[model samples]
Target: MSLREAVAALVSDGDLVAIEGFGHLVPVAAAHEIIRQGRSDLTLARMSCDVTVDQLIAAGCVSTLISSFVGNSSAGSLHELRRRVEHDDPAPLRLEEYSHGGMVARYTAGASRLPFAAINSYRGSDLPTLNPEIRTVTDPYGSGDIYVVPALRPDVSIIHAQRADEHGNVQAWGILGIQTEAAFAADRVIVTVEEIVDDDVIRSDPNRTIIPAHAVTAVVECPWGAFPHAVQGYYDRDDAFARRWSELARNPHEMHVWLDANIRGTSDFDAHLELVGHPRDGRLNVTEAFPSPVNYGGRR
Candidate 1:
């Protein structure tokens, strides 16, 4: 299915949506669609929010952000997020903060159908004070006081992968990140892949099948879907573009102008790629590497 179709069908305003991919395979394209559709008042969840989430924040689609960290890479301030947190530029954004470990535990709990997850985070820190949801409980095993975060089960989870079969069995390697847990925790899962491969390819390497078909609601084949954020074997991150975006994001007017021309003005990701001189003249492409083939075969 097409990404636009998937987003339009499954995503609704004011839904708890999560687009997870960690550092690599960030679903920038899907976020752009969310912005393009003008969906408002959404509660977004991500472990490492990064620049991809920043785009959604800047667009004003997000009402509340539930995350451990909002900005990780770009080696500089994510200006739009900072503007909202400090200045309340466009609107007042509510933030639900947690530690990286706490977030993972929360997602784990959500996937496991638990009420909350206990972790050793924020013991001496003031993060607990900021977030009222963070609670303390005495360990039943006599380990002492424990901090726990509520399970984060999103209404919809969108993630990028290297490939998926027709049945929507997602295969991702390099850094699998939190896509699996996020997908399982969500009510609906939308997977955008660089390619749609045969079932045999997936069968040959079961270990790489991160999100199984039964958990996926939709599969979108979108090459370069994670542009400016790399897709492991497909392409590399576009740091220069990211830095340029940071510069524009400092000023609201300039930021919107760039978005208008690059994101909203374009018909789709392919058009955006064309407008930005992508294929990067073949510069962003990665070289193929041969790996030892593992047999997942038996007496058929």
Candidate 2:
């Protein structure tokens, strides 16, 4: 299905949406589509709330954020996030703050269908004070208390990958940040990929199939979808756009003007890319490299 259809069918207003990828492969295109569709009051989640989340907040689509860090990944602050937090400029943004470890444990617990996860991460931290959800209990069999974060089961989780087969079997590599856990924990999953390959291609590299088709609810083939964030084999991060966005995001009106002109002004991501000077031939491509192929013997 198209990204439009997927988001429309799977995502709803006020949904707890998780768009996961560490430093790269963030589903910024899907984010744009959600914004284009005018989704609001979302509780957005990611380990690092970077440009993607910043844009959502800037557009007044997000009402809350769940993550450890909130800043631009490459440089500078997420002024929009700061604006909402400090002044409530566009909207009141609630936050569920946790350490990176705490968030992973929460997602892992949710994926495993557990109630909560206990960890030693918040032992000496002050995050628990600000966010009261981080609680503690005495270990039944052991000595002392431990901090626990509740499970984070997102209503829908979106991820961008290098490729997936028509069956929605997703395969990704390099800096996969809890994407598997996030997808498993989600009630529905939407994957936007750079390309869609044959099942034979996905079967050729079974180890790379991090999220199987059974867990996926929608598959969207969107080349350059993870643009501005490096997709493993397709393109490099668009630092130029990020820098410009950061500067514009400093002023709320300018930020919305930019968003209106660049994102809302276009029909789809491709048009937005064209408007932003994308389709840079050969410039963003990575130098070709391949690893040794391992054989999965058949016909025993």
Candidate 3:
């Protein structure tokens, strides 16, 4: 089956999809394709929201969101979500704020198949105020410190990596970042990679291979998959686009127009490439001029 199909298999109506990546690096490309194909009543979990969140929200694929924050720092700002929340829209966006360590602990508990994991990171913090479900239970073993957090098991997990084998072995390159836990906790896994290397390359450095083939259901080779988002040394992020999106998002009409022009109405990345101009041989011209922003009936 194709990588998209493999990823799509894990998604269903009303599934809670947990995506592994921060800002832009290592986004679940195949999962996005699946979402574009149309699924409803979806709840998304991520460290922070960015282009991926914007695209899913614009597509109307996401019914709820669970993240610490949303919007691109480089983008002018994130107002759409804030406005929606402030207005208390019927389908008000669900914002679950958690500390960095708390988020990691939740994912780890999910991966371990444990009912809850003990942590003392948020003992005196406001994190519990936002999420009252995170109970402060005493240590069963009589340990003086540490509290337990309920396990978080998403229906499916989609992640991106630098390389993978056809069998689905993934090399996260030291920035594992919740992927290992996500893989352990999710019912299914779908992975996308820059390239599919030989099994020998993966076997040679077993420690580097974060996700084993057994855990991954699909492996797709997607070059430049993390466009507009950075992948460490691989490519510079499109901070300009992010900034513009943030600025336009303040006005709903303008946001829709911008989405239509850039993301929506476009079939795939190739079309997006045409709209934004493709990088020359995997190298972008930082000095090259960018297109002027389209007017969307909002403050410019």
Candidate 4:
């Protein structure tokens, strides 16, 4: 399926959607597609909540954000997010903050179909005071006080992978960062990849299969799906573009112009690629050249 189609089909209004990536393979294209489709009143979940989350908030596509931290790579805080929460610019953003470990526990619990997850975090922090979602639970083994967070089962989970088969078997490497858990926890999963390969290629390296075909609802072959963010083994992070976004997207008017020119203006992902410059231009090539061979059959 196409990126636009996948976003339209999988993501819906008021859905709890999670587009997650740690440092690499961020699903920026899908987020843009959501904005282009004019989906609003969404509750977005992510770990770091990088550029995509910021843009979604600026576009008024989001009403709530669930995450540990939200920041640009080197551009400091996401000014748009700050403005929404701080000044209530476009709309007031309802926040559900959690510690890094607490979020992981929540996703883990959801993936495992558990009601809640207990962790020994936020003991001395003000998260429990600030966020009511953070609750205390008694240890079953009588170990005294414990902090627990509810499972985060998103309505849809969109993730960008390095490669995938037409059957939706996703293969990703480098900085996965809770993608598997988020996919497993979601009711529907949409995977946008750099390329869709033969089933044999995916089967050859089964270990790289992060999200199996059964968990995926849609498979989109979107080249440069993680534009402006690094896709390990495929391309380097577009730091210049990231910085430019940080500078220009602070103002609401500038954000509108940026979205109109780059997102709404482009007909499809191919047009987006052309506007952003070709991936083969070498500007976004990987800094390191470590080519690890895929060992299919090994005698241990």
How many residue-pair clashes does candidate 4 contain? 0
TM-score of each: 0.96, 0.97, 0.86, 0.95
Residue-pair clashes, model 3:
4
**Model 1 lDDT per residue over 261-284, tens place:** 888898889998899878768888
Which residue pairs of candidate 4 clash?
none
Q: How accurate is candidate 3 locally (lDDT)?
A: 0.71
lDDT of 2 by residue, 1-300 (tens): 998899889989999999999888899899999989999889998889888788888887889899998877667889999988888876678988898999999999999999999988787889989999899989998978888889999999999999999989999998789999999999999999989999999988899999999999999999999888898777888787778878888888888888998888889999888888875666688877687778889997
Question: Which ten contiguous residues of candidate 3 have the minimum total lDDT?
Answer: 284-293
The numbered model that scores best in TM-score is 2
Among all windows of 10 consecutive residues in model 1, the one with the lowest summed lDDT is 68-77
Q: For candidate 4, lDDT tens digit of each residue in 155-186?
A: 99989999999999999988779999999999
**What would the TM-score be for candidate 2 when compared with the true structure?**
0.97
Query: What residue pairs clash in candidate 3, if any at all?
Result: 75-242, 75-243, 118-147, 119-147
List the candidate 1 regions with Cα displacement exceeding 4 Å: none
- TM-score: which is higher, 1 or 4? 1
Cand. 1 TM to true fold? 0.96
On lDDT, the candidate that comes out on top is 2
